[model samples]
Target: MNDLPFLQHFIVLPVLLPLLAGALLIPVKQSRYSLKFACSVTSTILLWVLAAVLLAMADGGYWPDGIGVYLASNWAAPFGIALLVDRLTALMLLLTATIALAVLVFSARRWDRVGIQFHTLFQFLLMGLNGAFLTNDLFNLFVFFEVMLAASYGLVLHGYNLHRIRAGMQYIAINLVASFMFLIGVALIYAASGTLNLTDLGARVALLGNEDTWLLSIGVCVLGLAFLTKGAMWPLGFWLPGTYASASAPVAAMLVLMTKVGVYAVLRVWLAVFGNDAGALAGFGFTALTIGGMATLFFGAIGMLASQDGGRMAGYGAIISSGTLLAVIGQAGGPVLASGLYYLLGSTLAMAAFMLLVELTERIRPPGAALIAITMEAFAIEDKPEDPVGQGIPGTLAFLGLSFAACALVISGMPPLSGFVAKFSLFHALLEVSPTEGKVPGLTWGFIALVIVGGLAAIIALMRLGVRIFWASGDIAPPRLQFSEAAPVTALVALCVMLTLQAGTVFDYLDRTVAGLAQVTTYSERVLGEPPVMRSPQRGLER
Candidate 1:
């Protein structure tokens, strides 16, 4: 598949198809929503299939360094916009498409009615997400970032109320500042190195002398802050719980993938320009990434324990997932990064599924039962017997209970799920350090402890949510759940189960991904073309 010349053309389809679909959707009347829905869904399904093919192409070795590039114009790097796809990029595309499909199906029942042009915005969001994963330059990355954020601004406020309005405003304000910082950082990097192309920047950054090193460092740090803000790191992330809590269920699920996008940016850019070739500039900012990851995890743990609502708790779970990935990236080793990648997949699916389930389970709970359940669990009250769960249970009750349990198992890293496998792999990777290496750092211990405590906190919070939704709510009749609503949640949870069953295969794939990302020189060379690189002299030093 990788050797097929004709298949290389499909690299541009992921971006182009969604873009064309979104443009077409704009003219359809709201009265013609069925047409809009059909177009949106069919495009997404085709996207999911296309992404699966690309994932296979990359894994089968599409090009040197396992990266396939599509030049938007005939011009080469630092001139024309370039889109590069590798195993990691392909993995994200598939993940984004999966979640988008589920969210679209889940929203079909009612939330689509909240506003005009909902499907239009949804397709554009997919376009932005696919473009972000595929782009190979900083400036193009920013353009896609704005596209995604712009679509989200509308989606977040779809069913406008006072709460949604306030949350959406905060989301908009923070991202605008982040966008400003991203632009400034790009300007600084270009001014120092004479290019905005990622591969060009990578090559030039390595050649930079002491004169431009500090400026490059400052620019990279500024970029990191913007991405960290998007990833929901501590101090900058206090708005996440409220934003997710107030969002409609499917929108919140989309936000779940959005959080991971920030983490993905940090992972790609940091390692690319700062890899082994960067000379004294190598390994810059990793310490800060570690410390920040710990702080974010600690903050998430406290927030999880304190949360009473399911939406808010799921928000904190995303914070914890981001924190874990950031910390693993800070470790900067193949084994640990492989583990973290698997963890990212499982936690993302589980959290998104849980967010969807929250809307349905709320149907069964009394208005104040979460608080009451918390009090009862804290005090160990004995009045409530276990609800009969296994046999003769109403089908609706049974479905919600099992789905919620699967989510808890995955999020909390409990036995018999992919979450457990992820954490165990992490622990093993941390312990399996080569004999040539020094004693384990305290930061490693700190990360281990944080993972443990974070998992415990999730267990408590989600367990309490379970008690409230299923046990304390007593004998309420099942709320009406549409097939569209139930199927999406079922599909997502089932994916986690599949991950657990196929853990070995998934881990091998992730390991190859980690290995591919380490080839920084190859990445730069392939994107820049086969000739000897024309050096970019340092700019603005004389000015």
Candidate 2:
């Protein structure tokens, strides 16, 4: 291991260490506390490694943007596990580690209540997430996905209460279907392409004939379905709110990583495997982007409008953000990619932080109240039941106002925050693609105007709701937050502050990341040898 090159080993360690630690925790005495300690230590180290990787990526420049680092047991592509760390992969790894840390910190109290299995399951889930991000092989991506999903099944159903069970079952069923589709997609892809290693496939996919092209189309569709399902895309996302709503705070926070994995896979595989060849497969790439994205965006917005429950509302918002991210990706060019990177980092961090806040609110509720009110009725519980009466409604309203404001800023892509940066960049991208200088024709302008209008509507709606919730008079009493519970919220706020202050640095980092991905030549050379024959005939034809 010591003789191995640093770059070859660095990427995989983040995945392997946690898995090994989780396995080690299983048989140890007082495994619960020991597991927690192990996870904390291991995750902290991983975080450092992740930071180092990001810095290295930034420094190394985009010269090798699409370069796939192979960890061959000294074996070649068709065999052995390979951990690839391209710009996108590196960014996702940092994000996953960041969120995992926050979730773990928030879960400290629940860890005491839930027992050892929660920690073990969580570690395993993280291992799966990290593995998915770094893995170069498509089959192994599916394998990592299943590992995470299986661990998630247990975590979702951890308490095994009736409500949790019901929700968990639905969640499991939906994901099971997705998993099956994913496997079938992989099979179809293998049949058509004859390889599962992403780099190798990218090198060879252009050589496919019409028959293989049709099969590959089906495979891409199936794979897209699986990713959309996991990412909580519209129509397929009906299960997300209920499942996330029922889970413990930490579990819900951790579950966010699942959506990210799906997103990462789509970006990694599509960009490299397809290598900017947008004309392939009867324009399947553009079709997936436009049709799938619009539907997801509309579904998420409608879901948010329809939601009454607080946690569920946030859950829908998460869906909307995911859709927006994908929409930006589908619309990819220079500006859109930059925007997506910014939003992906910012929104995920924001959502993770907000989710942690909601959990804290549950914990700080009145002493006599159950940690969570299981009754189906709309209820507000508080900490210190003896503190006073008639303050609940006001307090709830205040908290709701804060949440709503953050949500507005996040979803609307408003100024002075990360969300705005993403949206603006995306709009810029649309402007680039539009043929008309004053007004673009077709989907480009259509999407631009629609997204802008949607963002504005969301902002207004959230603001109005915030006013009603915070200012409206209701006799309900308020809950209080302890310092420990407040820690996560404070950490998130600190992150927001850092994001604001270091906006320039953040943008530079994202630009570097995008530049890395957009290097078509680097990608072509790495995957397809010295130079790909740019068929001028293929290049000049417009769809």
Candidate 3:
């Protein structure tokens, strides 16, 4: 381990770098917008680089157990705070950094200038995201969750537009409730298990008596609800579309990962603390998760079809991705879970790019034309000659149209894109499990149907929107494209394409990640410095 003492320190940098950067930018005057922008861009790029290195180090070839634990102040687990850098955590950090960097680059054009302290809030958001992904204790997770949410509150309302403020209020209200529930759940878990360290909690869970088990189960349910709310699972996610649509393009893009953080928390806590070894607690909320995920999928699909606004459609797409991941995870199959991870990555990139592309496309269209056209189409009215005509640079229309089409294909999971590969991989994984072996459950068919039908719904919605904006109406002008704005979208889409090109390598890494998640013994030994104790047979629990 001492062979790379520096890597141990790298684990904390994802949190510390952003924290310090955000704090330092707070005192900078508005006149130094250039300085703030430069600092934010540099910090995000460096964070992405650092995350990439950490991910590489944590890969199974370098760290076969897939854990790189860091104890602050040289402390040990279950007593002091720990920063665990497993493959999953490292992957999340990398994803966060990648999206942050792209969003920051996209924001540099003008969005950052619309509001003061934008850079500071953005950095704080990164700090919170990194902290949440890295923290090993439940209380610290709450702390980081709050940090992320607080920064998001500012970002959602950054421009202070009337619509943004209205949506931000609703977003803030919902998340506050979720936070309260999270606190209550954490308190209950700590009360029942006498610990909040995840690995320690896992070790202790199997040994809990009937009463403690009952309390812990309640705590787990409450915690899952909190996470599901943040994940935008159906009923709890009503605020997501409005909130995302109201934010600035880059801010909306960064907000894509916020839902994923909730999903990550559920996956981490469920598998680590209440996995198969938790006896009666085993598969505690699988039924709820599976059903809720399907419901979320159905809701998002319908929402996407109903959405006239591009940003809102992207929001629904995110919800659909979250639902897909949640349902796959609930199934508890290795190959399917791995495919879900891939799907999560692809969908997030595509959604972020879509959010950015929405603004660019909207810039080229005549103001109010989209809404008017949608209304007219809904009412089956003919277009009037007096309708506004869009005007702009010659090639801008084609560029915007192509970018919009690419985003549409991606969001709709169409062919020759990363989205298609991701969905195909997921479907393939699900089908690979033999019905003869009884691994194919009833929910499997439901999940498969949702995945297929949701994609079809997205395709229809996007095509309709695209045709109205690009071809059906003559109210579009060429949009003015800047390198700062255009490059990020291009880069994001390119990254997705890269994922498709390198699907084999990416799937291999995901397979290793899934294997690492199943290594309960290795994880327990690493975190606790000893093997986990088995429950007594008289306790009516089995591993």
Q: lDDT order of candidates, best first? A: 1, 3, 2
* Per-candidate TM-score against the hidden true structure: 0.92, 0.84, 0.92
Model 2's alpha-carbon lDDT is 0.67
Better of 1 and 3 by lDDT: 1
RMSD of each candidate relative to the true structure: 7.6, 7.9, 7.5
lDDT by residue for model 3 over 1-543, one digit each (tens)? 445545568989999999999999999997787999999989998999989988988984555477887777666678888888888888988999888988988777477876679899999999999999999899999999999999999888876756777788999999999999999999999889999999889888989999999899999889888998999998988989998888888889988999999999998888887678877787777777878889999999999999998889999989988888899878777898898898888889889988988887776577676578557545543211121233444577776777777777777789888788888888888888737565676777888899888999999999988887788767554666667777788888888889889999999999989988977767877876622224486864222
Clash counts per candidate, in order, are 0, 10, 0
Model 2 C-alpha lDDT per residue in residues 100-183, reported as the tens digit of each score? 776766555444345446666777888888788878788889999999999999888775566777889999999999999999
Inter-residue clash pairs, candidate 1 = none
**Clashing residue pairs found in predicted model 2:** 365-382, 365-383, 366-382, 366-383, 391-477, 391-478, 392-476, 392-477, 392-478, 393-476
Which numbered prediction scores highest in lDDT against the true structure? Answer: 1
Q: After superposition, how far is residue 259 of candidate 2 from its true place, in Å?
A: 1.1
Cα lDDT computed for each candidate against the true fold: 0.86, 0.67, 0.84
Residues 1-543, model 1: lDDT tens digits? 333556766888998998899999888888776788889999999999999999988888556667888777546776888888899999999999999999998877477766778898998888888888899888899999999999999998887766778888999999999999999988888878888888788788868878788888888888888889999999888889999998988999999999998899989888888778888788888778888998999999999999999999999999999999998888888999999999999999999999999988887877476568557555543322122232333598889999999999999888899999999999889877622356777788888999999999999999999998888877787766778888899999999999999999999999999998999888877888833223457642110
